[model samples]
Target chain A: MRAIVLAEGAPYAPAPLSASHPLPPPSPDTTLVTIHAAALNHRDVWIRKGLYPKIVPGSVLGSDCAGTDESGRRVLINPSVNWASDPRAPENPDIYGMLGLLPLPGTLAEQVRVPSRLVHPVPSHLDFVHAAALPLAGLTAYRAVVTRGEVKPGDKVLITGIGGGVAIFALQFARALGATVIVTSSDDSKIARAVKLGAAAGINYKNLDWRKAIGAHGPFDVVIDGAGGEGVAVYIKSMRPGGNLVVYGSTAGSEVPLQIPIVFLKNINIKGSTMGNEAEFKSMLELVSKHEIVPIVSSIVDGLERAEGAFDMMKNGNQFGKLVIRVHEKHHL
Target chain B: MRAIVLAEGAPYAPAPLSASHPLPPPSPDTTLVTIHAAALNHRDVWIRKGLYPKIVPGSVLGSDCAGTDESGRRVLINPSVNWASDPRAPENPDIYGMLGLLPLPGTLAEQVRVPSRLVHPVPSHLDFVHAAALPLAGLTAYRAVVTRGEVKPGDKVLITGIGGGVAIFALQFARALGATVIVTSSDDSKIARAVKLGAAAGINYKNLDWRKAIGAHGPFDVVIDGAGGEGVAVYIKSMRPGGNLVVYGSTAGSEVPLQIPIVFLKNINIKGSTMGNEAEFKSMLELVSKHEIVPIVSSIVDGLERAEGAFDMMKNGNQFGKLVIRVHEKHHL
Candidate 1:
């Protein structure tokens, strides 16, 4: 089996690619997934560049994928695996699943082994390219907007950062939930595009006071911040009392100076969410199927050979939505 | 009428008491409460010293008090008064009423005018000193432990600091809610007292590896941090996944370095709560009446004349519970 294995942490310029990997047989309770398409995430880029200190030399870096099992069952892989089972966990799978950060191997190869329960049946209407994009980013947005944010119809939601996969999904999910979606983008074009994608308003964070612009929207019930920093504190101030701030990714920076008194005075709730639980995943998929909300696929690279290029495009910020790697030939499959 | 007034922000010794002023009359829709007792909180001390920049000079400083209205009805004053009302707020006469901060004068005076709705019938069983202690610290603890922490039977709760008014209330509240309470205290005698007050375990945080001691208790479901600093980050790490950390006051100083990834990975929630809402106040009063939870009153000083002495006791950390100022004699009417 051909796999894009990183031997060492190096810049994408060296274009290191290796081809002599053997596909390991599935262990007990593990299902072997023949990868058809895998999507790139910012985490993968960070993992590849060794920004994640735990990444070893032999780590396979992708977390989101869709493919078929040995029995020819189509599925989308849920990539978060936990060793300790929480009874309250949404998915009570028999074995650990694909949580890319831990000891579990990721899905950037031709074939990957995951716990059977982690694989959800993809709707027949959705193809592998779109299905592959739904696990990590989609679940993150789902958890942020629905599960954690508790966004409901008539609620106003403010999503920070446009063009990022999670932000785009958040906009669509908020819209599907009947919320008035507002988004922020540094790029003018991205703001326009976000508005076309059902956003009630889009703020150019680069040119205007995003806090004042978002304040004009006045007291959003929920604010989803992908950009962590002082910006999160600013957004928190824009929420009405009892409003929620769901923080997932902090792409901008992490050290945010916060005024603790304001948080207490306003009675604001700040919740940090990662990707969604399995129940949330199913709920999102159900919404997608019902609403026919297709994930915005920015670009689909032809083969696994161009994995480096796709990652480069992501790093250079030239891509909008998800960049998928089609690993297998349709005729061959 | 006599009042403890700070003509300017200065040291306690330099700040003199003013006694020539007459009691202000009540306005329409408002009642003049002849304050029978006022409790000294850190907020009062901060306000007097002008540590709180928002408080203007000559502003009376106490936020918690119990007194008799012009109609001679015994009442506990709600301190939080925001001018803007949320229509969705619950409907109980005491459900959304508070007098001291905004839209109302501060409570440290011989007589203060409050909207009639801001008054609640004090539990007939509790005296003025106990009722005064109940509003600010008791309500903060009630909201933090019950509303924010959602403590339940068999849940393990970690409370940092023990001798302060809120921490004492938290200890009582957590135990009443059937949670196993663990507390941290620097004072050895305070630890012993906390245990007697229902703390299952106590850690002297002055010692190193306090986290290890806390970790030995396994993961806490809720960690209430009143002492802020790098110590809170340690407490946050001690929480189980999906656990909540309710921060109400920061006595240890505010700026603390945080690891953002730990927050996301553990799915921890950090909520800042001040004194609770009007509903919480009424609910706490009911709990006090039903459960017969008597607030620990350390000392009750006489009127505005000795108010400075009570404040001094609170500032010097000599009091185990609420240091209350008895404003007037019961037979004065």
Candidate 2:
């Protein structure tokens, strides 16, 4: 099978996935998927650069995929495993990990095998490219906004770092749920784009007084923070008493300094969340389908051979949404 | 009415409350109570040094109390108002203020008047001193341990700085709910006393590596922290994935530095809570009655005249449990 493999020294290579079927499913309860499209995430860039943990040379490298199964069902795979029964956390976290690492075949290949339970029908509104874009970022945003934030109709939501795929999804999902969405981005154009995409307001956090500026618009019900509280004091200050701040990721360094007294005084809740469970993955897809929310595909490169181009675009960090690799032409199983 | 009023410059005076009908209940639905006992909180200490917000000089200055109401019902005041109908927060935070300041008379008095809704039946097991200790600290702990932490039976729980009133109540409440409670205090004597009081284990956080030392006992399901996360990284490191870290106050300085990545990667939650709402206060009382959990009272000063001594002891922070002022000899109403 053709796939993008992590090669020795030179990094990502288009190679034949061999060595006695290392990519094959370990169980009979699993099905093979002919991947039509796969998306690039920061994990792929990190693995390629030897920045990620437990990297295996010659393993196919991609976590998000849209494909056709043996039953010819249009599907997208849940990127995680070993957490089907537990909604709060994986039942056994020691064995829990996302796909694309060793012991789990990546979706960058022509075909990949996975547990049948990890496969779900793709939202009816999306194609292989957009569906491939949805799983990892969409599920993460869903957990932060709906599951953790408890965003209701008329709730005020603030999503930070607007251009990233996850933040964009948070904005769209919060809006879909009838929330008044606000976004923060250092780039004015990104903020403008977000405002155009139905956000009630946008703030370029580059300004020294952006935090103070933000307070005028809020007393927000929920703030979706991708970075930890580098601006935590400001975030909590803008929150209503008893408001919730759901943090999904942290780009900030080791110690995120926060004004802890405000949290004590204001009755604020700070929850840390990440990749969601299987049930949340299903709910995310349902929400996408019901609201006709399309995954924002910032850039797409054709052919499995051109997967690195998508990776380069993602690494450059200017893309507003997902970077996808259209792997197969027709993918007729 | 004889009450402990905040005297100009001198501080915490047991002066006779003069001014025409100032201590009388403003509404027809309110009741007047003859206070048998009153308790001191850190807020009382902060207000004494002129450090707390919205200080109303000459106002009676205490929050926790147990007394006999006009109907001969033995009761304790809820300490807060405008939040009776709102479970999550005060309906109008602008009007939301606890007793012990102007508009709401302090509990350190011969008699206090309040809305009927703010008064609750005292636990059958507790006398005036213990019941007086229960309201503020007990309500705060109940929110941190049960309402926010969602601590379940058999859960391993961590309660930090266990010598203080709120932390001690958290220790007892978590234990009463069938959780394995562990405590941390700088004083070895305090830790020993907490273990004797029913904690499963104790660690003296005075040790330089107490944070790492704590890991051997847990993988805690819930951690009740009175101080904000000075040891947040260590706390989250010892938390089970999807565990909750509830922060109720910050004894540490203004800024709390936390390892943000661990929170994001571990699926940990850090919530900020203070005094609970009316429903939570009722629930705390019910739990106390059902379990016969007595609020630990360390020192009892007799009569409103000696109220300043209770304030001084709380400020010094040498006590292991609540410092209570026994306001009156048994009152027949």
Candidate 3:
């Protein structure tokens, strides 16, 4: 099988590809997926650059993909594996499960093995590339807005960094829930795109004080922050008393200085969410299927051989929505 | 009517006292409580020393008191008063209501008027001083642990600075809920007292790294933090994944420089809780009554004349529990 294997930690300019690798047979309760399309994540760039120390030298680096299994059913790979079994699962001892992070290999290859439970049947109406984009970023946004933020129909929601994958999803999700969505973006084009996507307002953070702009919105009930650092403090100040601030990523920076007195005085709640649980994933898929909400496919590269180009486009932030690598020929089962 | 009034804000050594002021008349549906005992809280000291800028000259400064109303019912005053007609009243506002920092007349005087709803029936077994101590500190602790923290039995709870009023109540409340209480204090005497009051473990923060010390017992399911400043970073690090860190006050100063990465990775929750609502107040009182939990009264000062002494003792941190002022003779009513 042809796979995009990380030979050594190097820049994207040095093409590193393994055309032939032995593919392992699927173990019991595991299905072997023939990758139809795999999406590029920022994590893929990080893993390939050796930014994450935990990644082994030869590890495949992708978490979102849509493919066909041994049974020839099209599905989206739920990349998040928990080695620790769900405490709620009746048959299992409390054992940890794994998603894409550890001992299990990632999705950026010709073929991958996953537990039957982690693969969900993709709706027949959805294409493989679009289905591949829904697992990681979609679930993350679902958990941030729906599960953690508890976004209500009339609630006012603020999505920071309008152009990012999760932010875009949050904007759509909040609007779909009947919330008034406000977005902040440094780029005017991105801000315009977000506005076109049903955002009530957009602030070009480069030109205006987003804090004052958000203040003019008069205190949002929920603030979903993808841009961390000092931006979080500004967003926190922009929240109404007893409002919630859900943080999933700190793309700007990690260390943020906070005013503890103000936080207590306002009685705010700060929650940190990562990815969604399996139940949340199913619910998100259901919402997408029911609403016919299509994931914006920025670009699709042909073949697993072009995976590096997809990674580069994502790393450069030139692509909007998600970028995918079509691993199999369209007519091939 | 006799009242403890600060003619001017100053240190307790030259404390001002005035007694010739007229008692406030009770308005519609209000109660005139003949103050039997008024507790000296840290707020009183802050108000007296002019640390609180809103406290005007001749302002009465006390938050907790228990006495007999005009109807002869034994009652405890809820100092957080808000006008019943205020738009925010639908939320069942507090006595002082949402304006927590404003200098409202306190409960230290021989005669005080409170809205009918702010006065709660006292348990017959509890004396005036004990009941007076339960309003501010007791309510704050209760909200931090039970209402916001949602502490459960068998959960490990951490209380910082156990000698203070809120910490003492938190220690008792967590213990009453069957949680394993771990307290941190700089004083050995306070540590000993906390253990006797039901703390499973006490760490002298002065002698050891509190985080390391707590790590031995951790990871704490709930951490009630009043000690702010950089110590909050340590406290946040001490919490278990998915645990809650409830902050009510920042005694050590409010600036908390934090690492946002740690928050997202650990999936922790940080909530700010103020003094509880009327429902929470009633619930706490019921718990206290059911458990026959008498507030630990450190000392009692006789007469309004000795109110200055009580204030000084509280300011100097010399009291183990609540420092209360007995405003009138036992038979005066």
Candidate 4:
């Protein structure tokens, strides 16, 4: 077994992973997955740079992967584990974390072991690469758009950071649910690409008055945002009374300054969402299957040895969709 | 008819309300009520000082009232009106506001008129002064604790700014619903008084480490807060995973700096609640009736001519519950 390990040092200038790491053993009630494809996420980049919390050395670093089980069934791995039965939160949240984070073995290796229940059959419409792209980002977007944000038919939905994996999935999911989708991105080309993917409109958020640009088309019913920072105030102003703003991640700083009076007076609801539960994971896959939606694979590098190339592309933040590593050939299993 | 008008001036500098202003007229589908008693909220203080939006010079300054309607029925007015049919928000949120704010005539007059639908029959257990104290604060608290906050039996609930009308009502509501209630106040005597009123514990927020005092007992299921400022960060830290922090007012300051990552990672929800809708007002009354809860009235001015006394007390923030203006004799109806 060969794996990519988070070598010591900052996230940038990392050539930490090695190809000859020893194979990890599978425990009872856990199945060994021969990973055919693995996807790189911003989380991976953050962990490698030591910017994220609880970074452990020698831990295989990936949260999204697809492969085959002992039963020879194609499966996608849900990286979120140890969730509480309560749909609202994870069990032992202080210690709760996703795969590739500290303590958990990620799917960056030739073979990885995970709890049996965390495995779901890949949607028939997807291959190993697309399935690998769907779990972490797809489930997060599903919870933000459908479960918490409560987007409905004809609802006006806005997804920020349009080129990111979660934002892309949220756009597609909202469209599938009959919502009129709008997107925002820093890059005009990425915005254009999102519009081509069926968004009703797109805005380059780099503009000083980006919110006003979106406001021209909004008073939106649902806003799926991952950037939690000073810019959240502008989004708040754009919301209609009683609108829902669902925040899934904070890539931009975490301390957000809010206008408290406007929030209550306008009857706006700000919901903070995260990785989502097992049930949501299942629902996300079902939606992908029913819609026959093919996830966008922005760039692909063949062989487990080339995983760093995918990481580099993700770090650049220019990719429009998932960056994948073909760990093993699809027929190898 | 006689009423108090918001004269142009700084809110705390002078006696802005004059008692000899002309009376207001009732609208269509509305009924005139000879007000027996009226209550003052912090909103009145803000409007008087011109700190709130949409301040009109001649508008009557009150929202909570108990009086006699046509046919001599004893009733209390529900200040929230023209709520949108959507369960999530008000119909015309921009214009929809409580009584006595601008646009709507408040209940601080000798005679007041309101939409007939906003009137609820006073519970048999209450008199004019207590009934008048219950509507604005009661409805806001009920919406925060039961409807939006989703407090359940045996839940540990935290109510901040316990001396205020809405916070007091929230304490009573959560306690009545079988929740273990804790309260915070800057005044030690007010905290002692809240504990006497059935709060399980109390902390004087004046202490620099007040959150540390409460944290020993918390990981609270629900926290009902009125002060929104730097202290909000401490409250966020005190919450357990999946906890709900319901904010109804921002008397401390409107610009609240929040720790964004903690909110999402803990799966905590920060909900902005205000005066409830028509349905929730009705539900609040039903709960009041079911529990036979007697609203606490902290001070009572003798006549509508002395309404300024109630306003002054609210500005001082010394009262532990509602401050009322006895507008007319109870038997005058």
In terms of DockQ, the best-performing candidate is 2
User: How much does candidate 2 score in TM-score?
Assistant: 0.95
TM-score of each: 0.84, 0.95, 0.92, 0.93
For model 2, report DockQ.
0.73
Q: All models, DockQ values?
A: 0.36, 0.73, 0.51, 0.70
Off by more than 4 A, model 4: A8-26, A329-333, B6-28, B84-87, B101-103, B330-333
Q: Model 1: runs farther than 4 Å from truth?
A: A6-34, A51-61, A69-74, A82-105, A109-113, A208-218, A329-333, B1-36, B47-61, B66-75, B81-97, B101-125, B204-218, B327-333
DockQ (0 to 1) for model 4: 0.70
lDDT of 1 by residue, B189-305 (tens): 898988988899899988887878887875898988887776777787788877888888777867666556667666678787766666777777887788778898888888777
The sequence of per-residue lDDT tens digits that candidate 4 reaches over residues A139-220 is 8888889887899999998899888999999999999999999888889999889998899988887898886898797888
> How far is B328's C-alpha from truth in model 3 (Å)?
1.5
- Over B100-170, each residue of candidate 3 has an lDDT whose tens digit, in order, gives 23345567777777677888998768988799888888878888898778899999999988878888999
lDDT of each: 0.77, 0.84, 0.77, 0.84
**What tens digits encode model 3's per-residue C-alpha lDDT throughout A1-333?**
676676764544256567665575658888888888888778778766667756666666678888888888998877656523221121221333334444676777778888878889997679998998778898889888987798999999999887777888888888888899988888888878888999988887787576677788857889999778888888878887778898888888888888887777777888887776677778888878877777877888988777767777887985668888888754232
Lowest lDDT 10-mer window, candidate 3 chain B?
B84-93
lDDT tens per residue, model 2, B1-333: 567777676544444333232456456888887889899999987887778768878778789999888888899999977676555566788988888887778887778888888999999989988999999899889989988899999999999888999999999999899999999988999999999989988888779889777899899999898766466667778999889998887785567677777777787888877888898888999999999999999999987777667777887998999999887654222
Q: Is candidate 1 or candidate 2 better by TM-score?
A: 2
Question: By descending TM-score, how would the candidates be arranged?
Answer: 2, 4, 3, 1
What are the clashing pairs of model 1?
A: A79-A98, A81-A99
Docking tier of model 1: it is acceptable
The superposed Cα distance between candidate 3 and the true structure at residue B244, in angstroms, equals 0.8
Error of 1 at B254 (Å): 3.4
